[model samples]
Target: MPVRGGDLHVGVWEPEGGGPAPPTVLAVHGITASHVGWAELARQLPGVRIVAPDLRGRGRSRDLPAPYGMPTHADDVAAVLDHLGAGPVVVVGHSMGGFVSLVLADRHPDTVSSLVLVDGGMPLLPPPGVAPDEMAGLVLGPAAERLQMTFPSRAAYRDFWREHPALGPGWTDLTTAYVDYDLVGAEPELRPATRVAALGEDIRELVDGDSVQHALDHLRRPATWLVAPRGLMDEVPPLYPDAARDLWTVRYPAVRMVPVEDVNHYTVIMLAEGAAQVRPHVVEALGEAR
Candidate 1:
């Protein structure tokens, strides 16, 4: 792990072997999620050199001011690109990270030659008449309060994740070691270095989007969308939309939105099977991008 030095420094992980790797794939995790979320995705992607950045105020790059919205994230990403001495790289982002990716392509098209949006990127028509702050509260309340709960020991953390709704059957098996990798104390609690306020700012960006669809329409790079199947039965929060994914034809014309199965919000990229499914698609995109 390396942290670039600057007002907009971001953390990065580069796998070994340097034979002119494919354009670095910048993996930006969703709200509050550290670069760790892409741990499994990165490991399976040895064919390409990839870097996952801790957005502005999240993870180890917590130096930026508040209101780290789409443009802010885009700028931070561009800065990270310049710092790495890499440009025109392909970007792969999940959930809120996808929104930032869209913004990146919109605002800094020269920095990104291609974009892969996993489980996000389209405009969300939140139920009618929902107030902004209330919607924000609904979307980010859990992370704001820190759902990465502390446990008496590492085993307790592993036990709790096995039953966690957001995780899948194999998440525990894959993440148990990764989550505890940086633990320090005797209790060995799982803790993230990401910040909460940064998460709130990210929610503010999503909920406050001036028509996220309009923003996404400006993407100029090659783009692909991988959507996780989501509906009422699997939805957790009571008020969030449970509608089946609608036709995105009105948004991204060149981008394809494909459904990914057997994976939820977490396991989609955090587990081996899910990554295996996506790895080939990404390789295809890399070939196209090149």
Candidate 2:
């Protein structure tokens, strides 16, 4: 789909026997991720159309220019729906994609009927005085570091993720495909496709952007936030910790919070077990949209 800066790359999955016009869901992957992140979710929800896009500066859309912020990403999503001639579909967003979903719902109110936010969308304050530009590298840690890494070969990159504590234990063909798709550049010099500068701009907004805050304050759409118990590295202190969850719950009572057990930030949408848990909520949201 052609949007603002360039032709956006979108991945669509048609349900097993879903003829023309099956219920459609617009999915958005996390920061540093591409449309392939939704592979498992697409498989799990075989009756609905799963449409995911590689946000500008990520995946194949890596060349899409700057001004990479939530509003820009939201507009790109709106353009995708317009290009498809689709109206108000349920939107599911994971990680930074969740933040984009919030702004989309708020900015393009008619574009999203409801939302399923997986491990993102709520506010996450930065450590006091941390520079906005540094937040991505600071918070993301390894996920951020890998963007600058060079792989000797595809297998080397696969090996890196295969050793990941969270993804390795549950590794599947889907993971392999995702890892493969993420690599760009020639062999022996392949690097992940996400642009570091784009990530920094987006992360700055996620950490303390006014758009997210305003979106939450006036959020009227039905939304569900699913949280992972572990962090990106499968560590205990997940992105949205218990206290943060509790505070957000009190602050935005309208957005329901659900806890997904034994999954890290990545696995919550990247693996079968996590997708199984997320399936019902997505179904419910789609059902209610009708």
Cα shift from native, residue 64, model 1 (Å)? 4.2
lDDT of 1 by residue, 9-80 (tens): 354556566666555788888876667778787788876777777777765566556657777777788877
Clashing pairs in 2: none
Model 2 C-alpha lDDT per residue in residues 19-70, reported as the tens digit of each score? 8678999999998999999999999998999999999999999999998999
Which whole-number lDDT from 0 to 100 does residue 180 have in model 2?
97
* Worst 10 contiguous positions by lDDT, candidate 2: 125-134
Leading candidate by TM-score: 2
C-alpha lDDT (0 to 100) for residue 65 of candidate 1:
62
Please list the C-alpha lDDT of all candidates, in the order they appear: 0.67, 0.91
User: All candidates: CA RMSD in angstroms?
Assistant: 3.8, 1.4
Instruction: Find the candidate with the highest lDDT and give its number.
Output: 2
Instruction: List candidate 1 segments past 4 Å from native.
Output: 1-16, 147-159, 172-174, 181-192, 211-214, 231-244
Residue 284 of model 2: what lDDT? Answer: 99
**Stretches > 4 Å off in candidate 2:** 127-134
